[model samples]
Target chain A: MARDRRGGSPPPTAVSTDLTRRARIRDAGLRLFSERGTEGATVRDIARAASVSPGLVRHHFGSKEGLRAACDAFVLERGTEIKERALFQGELDQPELLLMHRYLARSMVEGSGAAASMFDRLVQATQLWLERHAPSETPDPRGRAALLIAMELGALVMREVLSRALGSDTLSPEGSLRVARAKLELYSQPLLSADAAARARAAMDALGERLDAAAAGEGRPATGAGDPGG
Target chain B: MARDRRGGSPPPTAVSTDLTRRARIRDAGLRLFSERGTEGATVRDIARAASVSPGLVRHHFGSKEGLRAACDAFVLERGTEIKERALFQGELDQPELLLMHRYLARSMVEGSGAAASMFDRLVQATQLWLERHAPSETPDPRGRAALLIAMELGALVMREVLSRALGSDTLSPEGSLRVARAKLELYSQPLLSADAAARARAAMDALGERLDAAAAGEGRPATGAGDPGG
Candidate 1:
């Protein structure tokens, strides 16, 4: 029951394993989660596939839920950040956002399946996150932030599908990011100005806090749900 | 089968059913299509829910596939038209773009099941459309036009899911639209001045005759078949 006690570095655990082994667990988790559904995959299965002990998995993640959450964060937060950076490698020279969009698309379609699997899990998890993270204040956190992330992920994947259909081969890290960039440019007009994007992001952070509180079953409900598209 | 002949202008054989009946069928179809995946639902089921005859369903559309195609057109083509119109609505005054985006969001989220179904169909249909419509000439229509439409549809749906999680019930067609417009602006930045959108769109029109046609299907083949994440 001793802790690794290492700050910054993932601590040593009760069960034997390494960082790469943990990644394998994530890789295995993404595949199973995407194919069956986040709710469908079990921790034991992921551990076995990763060639690790279930005890090790538990020691690392604390629980199956913890592992799922970690996988979601890893794919969406880290992967997207990485892909975005990769896409705009030289936006100034390219000038054409579409070209950059095409390049980033490579990350989604042709990127490692591990990336794609984590992506699938993130989309589904966004909902659960809202459920878990809703604020306790009145009115919901206004899922605008969640939706933006969702749209980004969906667009990323759809770009992959469209690329393959268009005959761009080998959905890979180096494939037609130019084409993907061009495709992404189709979305440029609607982008929030830097100021607006900031405000929106802020609103989202505030909303997330509210959602977390509310989902905890405390606080005034937000009036944002007055909509009745039903 | 006897025609409704309700219009009295003529015994409309093609769209013979009145708007009311057609509306009923569409509403029923949209609902069922959402609940049941494309492969799972049937015309009989749709007609039964609409309280109409299967004959009417068949008469309105040649078959189940045709009906589904019509549904896609209804959601996608019509939705795009709405989206494009909203782009300019707020440019003048009152920030109408926000309303427009919200309205678009409603169409996307409320129409989620339909949008999801449309996409599944579109994924395969894009291929068929290319095959049948791809002209055997020297000018290839730009491949990205249909792809653009498809991507936009995904964006709209993505935003709706966001609205759902944040519990933003005010996700009107107009409000959601603003969000989409903002995103599209960022997406299309490079093309705004250059008329790239226009050129790309026209290319799609001309591509039929002169597609790269590089030995049809010569484009890269998908490598690493089967889920790589595994």
Candidate 2:
């Protein structure tokens, strides 16, 4: 046979077909799961949507839960690729910022199933990225990441709510980016003087140690693992 | 008729019965609407859940939309009462603050139905309340109220997402409130010295005016009334 122009030889028909079938099922599952929730969609529903036999779904993914996990991994990888690429340039222009907000907002609202996991992955990626690029010595990196994520997520997830509350469509891409940038810039300015930030950090550190000890005394993990009230 | 100890006269059976039925239907609608979205629920589902006949639902509510409206009004009123009461004591203790955050978070998540409208109403109520209680001359009160609402809603809605992202249970009432308060305290300290906030506000004002004029030229309302993109 003639060599493939794309480079590598084509996989065996059986293997390629298997890959296609699995991907079809995964993509179908992602759409449905994103629209409804994981709990809301059934294996039969996904199989039917994917135009595949239910037995095939079980054969490839084992169970509905397994399929969901696969979908989560797939979507998270796709989403992370986009986000990392977008912020890779270091500084963002207006369009780039808007794109970031839009992607994040969509992921947040389509929050059931893989989207939720995707969000967590995105945050981790973002935090790691922030640490590498904008390494801070004064403001705690983790705390700063949490705040930044909260602000971005808030703008996207609550856009309509914000629009209604603010008497403007603050959720619109342009509108949201504008407000978000302003707020981010404003917030980036140290709310407390450097001395105060250090003092606050110290106080929080002490509080955290005490809480951890208290939790340990109660035979619970310090990071609130045993707290059922959450 | 026998005299009633609790009142001057007993309510007629028909009126009281009607009131009881209406209230029963309303409460059931509120719970269902909060749990699912307005569109996700149906008149039959609500009536069945309420233990009332479908005919009764239509007789009382006119339609499903009508019932949803009633539910929105009811939930909003209840929520506002709790929030206003929480803040009424001037300053909030941790518990009080937690309560406020919990209520707001629930409202934000239950947003697809009446909660969206309720958020707008809450913002209006909050703005009015702030103007009366903590009138500010330097920072624009309306802008400040919008920012505060955005921040609170952000924390609540994204708490789970935040928790997942931050590798902590940010949704735990106490934990979330603690982190939120710290962040809030930090944010409340003027991010920008007085001058920066004014400058940002001015820039936004000019942008707003330009958009408003453009909207007028297009024979549309300035505040994005006609934009369907959102």
Candidate 3:
């Protein structure tokens, strides 16, 4: 059955051909969707971008919403892929955070990915995934681990924001690289020494306990230590 | 002569609209800008949103771009107002990190200021501003201090990105609020204690110096921490 570009179900298959075709469709979708936005983009626009027929899009996905769903998955999987490759490059607990930041910066500053508008959808998907997987029992260490990892990445963006608000300008490519490197370096050091990491974990655990207690109190619990909350 | 929104030139002080009309125009612009992207929106939209005529929109803003530029400034300024107010609310040595975070989150999550997509523009604008101003420094403590403050606010959006990437489904109101609070808690902690902050800064500085040494030295740096980069 042929599908319209507006939305449809992707064809079911385990073969290489199917995988390659799916990739083609997703790549095209990312470019067009980012450019036109979710509501603005049409299936034909995506098909044209992918060099595939509209029927092929329809034949694979059930509808426009389905294609969007697939695109969401594709962007996410790619984000995961970037995370993996950046970390795998060398031995440092963190390869230069700047390098990783650069990789993301490339996606955000240079390409179709720069739209940054799609972030809303990605966030929504993240919530649904959390609900399904973060079951009560084991703490879902995997998801928790990913969340903490993400906080570090967020640090770079934070640095950029701070720089701009005060400086009235953005980080040039080289400077951003330098600052991001500095942040990543700072983030990396404690981890390098297992002794320090254990100490840090203990401190964090204590702090978390205090927070839990304070939160339970009549009013909001005051977090101890330096306020990183700003 | 009519004044332009980009601050090209203000009309002579003698030519003035009553304060009420000025407020009405700014209000109308904000409403339209949030609903329609800065690009998608027109003067007609602003006027309509304000229940005024397009001529009135021009009379107030001078042109479509002018209105948009003004709107952009308004959104940025409004978001920063609470922080600016709160900065003076506490002692000079250390401020309440939780309060700061709450103020920022309240602005983004609750304000009439542009929501997420609109925020995409604000975040990028801040980055743009950082890019321009950060390297313009001349070893002045004032510049550095200002930059640090800006970096702190930047952390808010940065943390949001991190929480989302980890698959927590942080896009919705509840999830976004939850993640915002967590990040607020994390980043706000440092602002509360002077000694803790001094130590953290010392650590970051040392790490930065070491990174510089490493970069000056050898081959590629180690891979970054966590699964994304690894």
Estimate candidate 1's alpha-carbon lDDT, on a 0 to 1 scale: 0.45
What is the TM-score of candidate 2? 0.55
Docking class of 1: incorrect
Q: Write candidate 3's Cα lDDT for B176-222 as tens digits.
A: 43443443332222111344334545654565566577778853433
The TM-score ranking, best first, is 2, 3, 1
**Best TM-score among the predictions, by candidate number:** 2
Chain A TM-score of each candidate structure, as shown: 0.38, 0.51, 0.39
Top candidate on lDDT is 2
| Candidate 2 wrongly placed segments (more than 4 Å) | A1-75, A90-111, A125-148, A164-168, A171-174, A189-230, B1-21, B41-56, B90-117, B124-144, B163-173, B181-230
- Report the Cα lDDT for candidate 3: 0.44
Query: DockQ of every model listed?
Result: 0.09, 0.16, 0.12
- Candidate 2, CAPRI quality class derived from DockQ: incorrect
Model with the higher TM-score, candidate 1 or 3: 3
TM-score of candidate 3 relative to the true fold: 0.44
All candidates: interface RMSD: 12.3, 8.4, 11.6
Model 2 clashing residue pairs (backbone)? none
